[model samples]
Target: MRYAICFTPTPSDPLSQVAANWLGRNVFSGEMVEPPAIRGIGIHEIAFHTAVPRRYGFHGVLKAPFHLAPDVSETQLLRDMMRFSGSFQPFRIPRIEVARLHNYFSLVPSVPCEYMHYLASAVVQHFDRFRAPLSEAEIERSDPDGLSAAQFANLHRWGNPYVMDEFRFHMPVTGPVNLVDMPRIEQALRNVFEPVLAEPVTVANIALMIEEGTGGPFRVHSLHPMGKVSARKIA
Candidate 1:
């Protein structure tokens, strides 16, 4: 199994429910949700466009997935995560929007957030000891040749290239779409997510997610609240 640290809204959060419906799967529950029908777009097209994000579910990655070191235990990792989260206070993203990220669409902050960056960096750095180094296959899978020099170096040193200075908080919604299809996909995403985005979203907890095996959907294992005061763990 591989473990990832992510920022997923609570399963009951309106944004989470809407995203799960749009993507046809709920990462929190590991269950399929029927996709809503769209005029002029076939269900198959919607399903196809969402296939990639559906597997990962609706969450912004904090720490990329990694194998546990042989000497590490899941219980120990959970304890560490719980302890680590206790030091920080919760913050909010003032606004969010459906934006094109590279070749795909995602929900991203409407403005830069220093607090979000700091939180993500802390998560990446703090739990790194639990990670096993990438295997040859994992390295090959990441396609180092496609990465920029700095990103390549970061990948080697941190196990994920997109953390720290490179990190942009994104909750992915679809697989790569052809540029020609971007306008329609963007409209679809905005139609579904805009209402939820109209209000500020809370960043109150960090979630521990688990993938049972290769190609499996990640499921929420636990949520650790962020604050200086001790908080209850949610499962």
Candidate 2:
């Protein structure tokens, strides 16, 4: 099984419910949700386009999936994650919007936030020791030759190319849409996600998501909230 560190909303959060409905799977609960019907979009079309992302569920990828190192255990990883989470305080992104990132649609921050980058970088660094080095199959799957020099270096170093400087926090809502279908899909996403985006998006907790095996749907393993104060010795 592979593990990923992500930013999933609590199961009860409206954002979680809405996104689960859109993607047709709740990563937190492992239940399927009915996708909303759109005027011009067929249910099959919605399902088709969402097929890839539906497996990943709804969350910003904090640390892309990786196998645990031979020396580490899931219990050890969990304990460290809890300790790491306590070091940072929760923060918010002022707003988010539906945008086509490269060829797919996702919700991205309306404006850049430095703190978001800092948090992502910290996550990548903090748990990297638990990550097993990428295997040859994994490297080929990532298309290392297609990556820029910096990305290639990051892949070998961090086991994920999109880390540190390359990280851009985005909550994917769809897999890929055809050019002719872009307008309809964009509108559909905006209609569903805009209301939730009207308020600030909170970054209160970090989640551990587990994929049982290749091509399996990822499920939430645990959530570690930020901002627990560590006791200090009085002088």
Candidate 3:
């Protein structure tokens, strides 16, 4: 199994519900949700667009996934996460916009925030001790040769190349999309998510997620709040 630290919205949050329906899966509950109907896009097309994000659920990654080191235990990681959460306070993103990330689409901040970068960097550095070193096969899968010098160095040092200066906070909404499908997909997302995106969104908690096996759906393992006072623990 591998573990990842992610920023998942609270279960009761409207954004969470919208995201769940859009992706057709609830990461918190590990259950499927029916996708919203779109005039031009078929349910099959919606499912196709969502396939990749559905496996990981609806969240922006903080620390990318890694296997636990042989010496570490899940309990140790959880305890450390609790302590880490107590030291940080929540912040808000003033606005989010739908944008293309390579061939995929995601909700990203209209402007980047230093606090978001700091929070993500802290998570990557703080819990890195628990991460097992990448095996040759794992490194190969990452396609290190395709990475830039800095990214390659980061992958070797931190086990993930997307942290620190490279991190862009985004909640992915679709897999690689064909050029012809982009318009309809974007329209469908805007129709359902416009109202929620009009307001500021809070960055309140960090979710611990687990992938039971390779290519498996990641499920929410636990949630830790980002302020002095922790909320009721959830499994």
Candidate 4:
């Protein structure tokens, strides 16, 4: 199994519900969710665009997936996650909006927040001891030649190409979109997400997600609220 540390909105948060609907799966429950109707877009088209991200569910990556180091145990990792999450206090992002990152759509902060970067970097560095070195196949899959110098270096050292200085907090909402369909997709996104984005988003909880098999769906393992001493595992 591979483990990832990510930021998932609380189960009750409106954005969580929006994402669950958009992505066709609920990370919290591992249950299928029906996609919302998008004007000018058929249900099959929506499903096609969401296929890639649906497997990972709804989350903003703090640490990309990694196998446990030879000596590490899941219990130990969970304990450390509780301690790490508890050490920091929660903060809020002023606003977030749907934006295109390459060919995909993701929700990103309207302005950068240093606190989120700091937290992401901390997660990468702190739990790195628990990450096993990437396998040869893994390195090939990352397309090292396509990465910039910094990204390549990070890929080798951190096992994730986008870490530390390269981190950008984004909750992916769709896979690739055709250039011709971009405007319509953007409209649909705005229609579904505008209300939830009207207010500041609190960065209050971090979750541990697990993939039980290679190329399998990721499921929420537990949630750790920032500045709190406890963790709640989902059944």
In angstroms, the error of model 1 at 40 is 2.5
Ten consecutive residues with minimal summed lDDT in candidate 3?
A: 226-235
lDDT of 3 by residue, 98-184 (tens): 988888899999999778899999999999999999999989999999999888988999999888888889999999999988888
Supply candidate 2's per-residue lDDT for 63. Answer: 93
lDDT of 4 by residue, 1-235 (tens): 9999999888999999998998889988989998988778887888888999999999999999999999999999999998888888888899999999999999999998899999999999999999999999999999999999999999999999998888899999999999998999899889989989998888877899999698899989999878844422211
- Could you give me the TM-score of model 1 versus the true structure? 0.96
lDDT of 3 at 44: 89
Q: Estimate each model's TM-score.
A: 0.96, 0.95, 0.95, 0.95
| Candidate 4: clashing pairs of residues | none
Q: Distance (Å) between predicted and true CA of 93, model 2?
A: 0.6
In candidate 2, what are the lDDT values of residues 1-235, reduced to their tens digit?
9999998778888888889988888888889888988777777888888888899999899999988999999999999989887787888889989999877999999998788899899999989999998889999999998999999999999998888888899989888778887888899888888888887887878899999678688999999988764322110
Model 1, global lDDT:
0.89
Clashing pairs in 3: none
**lDDT, residue 111, candidate 4:** 95
C-alpha positional error of residue 215 in candidate 3 after TM-score superposition, expressed in Å: 2.4
